[model samples]
Target: MLDVKAQSIANLRAQIKAIEEDSGAHGRSEARSSQCNGNASRAQRPHRRYGTAIDAQRNPASLPCGCSVLANSENDKQRFSQAKQTEEERDQANSAFAKIQRLLCIREHASALLYKRLLASGYEEHIASEAVQRAIDCGLVSDERYADVLVRSRLSQGKGLRGIAFELEQADIDPHNVPAYQEARFRDSGPDELARALSLLAAKPPKAKRVREAAYRKLVQKGYETDVAARAARIFAEQHDSVAIETR
Candidate 1:
């Protein structure tokens, strides 16, 4: 029985040893399997592509919108400023033009008054003469031509010498020239003036005394002396008397 017990113990020990060895082998296989699974997972893992990495790292906020809104805003502001400046310049130009027009009107009126005042004040004749000449040059009046025309028209209208002289003085005509003009106007009259005067007299209604009075007054009023008026009226009456005799 003792010999059988020892053999059983030895057999049991061997079985236990075999069981321990199997357990150790199984643990080592399990470790190798875990390592293989780790290796396989590492191999299967996706690689980081350069484009994807760049895209992930890129900031949308950093990207340019590529629109001209800012530039356009600046350009619009510049245009608006230029337009504002141009409008201001135009307004200033209009204001200047209005001022020039007003000044011109004042100058013209002042020039007209200057001659009258100069004559009345008994200013130096040359100064008054120059003022009139300047006014003529500036297109205000033409003294020489106007004087000639005025004298002729007045005498033709039968204005008296006194009335004509008075009017000439009022118009700022040269006092020196008025006498010459009055004399020359009558002196220059001739056979042509006689014919015209007779014709004008003939047109009058024959009231005899009234006609003579009107003819005398008209000639006298025309810057003619009393002698000239009487002579003209006599000459006109004689021609009419001759013509009446011829008609009978």
Candidate 2:
């Protein structure tokens, strides 16, 4: 199979070589024909002196008005084509560089999110990949750095470990990085799970047993552990019972 594939590639290269040779031969033939036609047309026209003094002094015959104009027009056309090609190349280079520059300008630090933004902003996949890789190399877009900050952010927002883990997953951070994530994970030295649960439970309006149970379920749904949720529910229920007794 490899031999057959190699042969096919060789055949394709031979075909391409033939096509290029044909195109060059055709281009040369056209160029000669156009030159002959231009010369013949210049010969048929009556000459009038209109060249610059230097042009006339140096070589008036070669820089006749018709021939000079045609030659300048062709040169201009070639120059314009070359300039357009150069502009396209420059634009691509600028876009690629600008994407990296934009990432560096982000003051909030970096993540896989920056890479996604570059891709979404219409950068080519390869360019985006290269930019992101460069960012990683420069430590300007470290997942570890992002994970540390994100864990702190989520914890400050009162999210639990499971919720934070899910958020990292959503951000496309690797599961293997979970150790780094945990190293920077939120820890409450002053409060155990039950204490945190109790505090969370204390912030609600008085409600019936079923609704309280539902709120406990909500906490669990918010990604707290089931054991913590149950403990908090117990504390909430006990406090409610105490309040009812005191009111009576």
Candidate 3:
């Protein structure tokens, strides 16, 4: 059994030695053939070169295509970045514009009211200001126009001059434009102030004792002048009492 084991060891060594020798001979043969193969490859492909740094002094053409590819890639990257930036800017501007347009469509607004609304809606001050300015430049947002509309509308609802004034002030209107706004929006065509006050009293009686004093207080609360409201209420009560006495 010992001799058998020694023989088996000898056989394994011989096999390993044969493998090494065969590998060495094959490597030598491949080395001798590689020179001819290298020359043939170069002859067939003179323009092509290899390696990470093919633009070496002796291999200029090796990376001409690579250099051009890199340049084109860089230019494309820059152009794409610029396009993205421009699109974002345009989108922001459009968003601001849409918000302003929506508000205007709902109703006319004074410049101050519009600006405050924009700011309250989370718009930046500069953007809101720009939007308001452009609207004004386009004649879309005007304090005077807003005042005129408001005054006329309120007058129809039985609001007196002082009532309209208070409303305009609260809406941040220009006080200087009030007189012009009143003249323009409410012409002298309708019933006089006194007549309107009488009509209001007829429609919605005051909570007072149906006397001039009660009417005067109600008119004052509705934004009438002290003297004008007192006179209107006095005249209205006198005429009403006369009619009642005559009917009785």
Best candidate according to TM-score = 3
Between 2 and 3, whose TM-score is larger? 3
TM-score of each: 0.36, 0.52, 0.53
**What lDDT does each candidate get?**
0.58, 0.67, 0.75
Could you give the candidate ranking by lDDT, starting with the highest? 3, 2, 1
Q: For candidate 3, what is the lDDT?
A: 0.75
| Winning candidate number (lDDT) | 3
- Model 3: per-residue Cα lDDT at residue 23: 100
Compose the digit string of candidate 2's lDDT tens values, residues 1-248: 99999999999999999999999999999999999999998865535564353444444444544554544565555655787888975676468656767756765445567667777888767666776776677666777767777776765555556767787887887644766445534444555556655666666433556746875786676667787777777777777778979999
- lDDT score for residue 237 of model 3: 81
* Residue 179 displacement in candidate 1 (angstroms): 9.7
In candidate 2, which residue ranges exceed 4 Å CA deviation? 1-110, 175-189, 203-209, 244-248
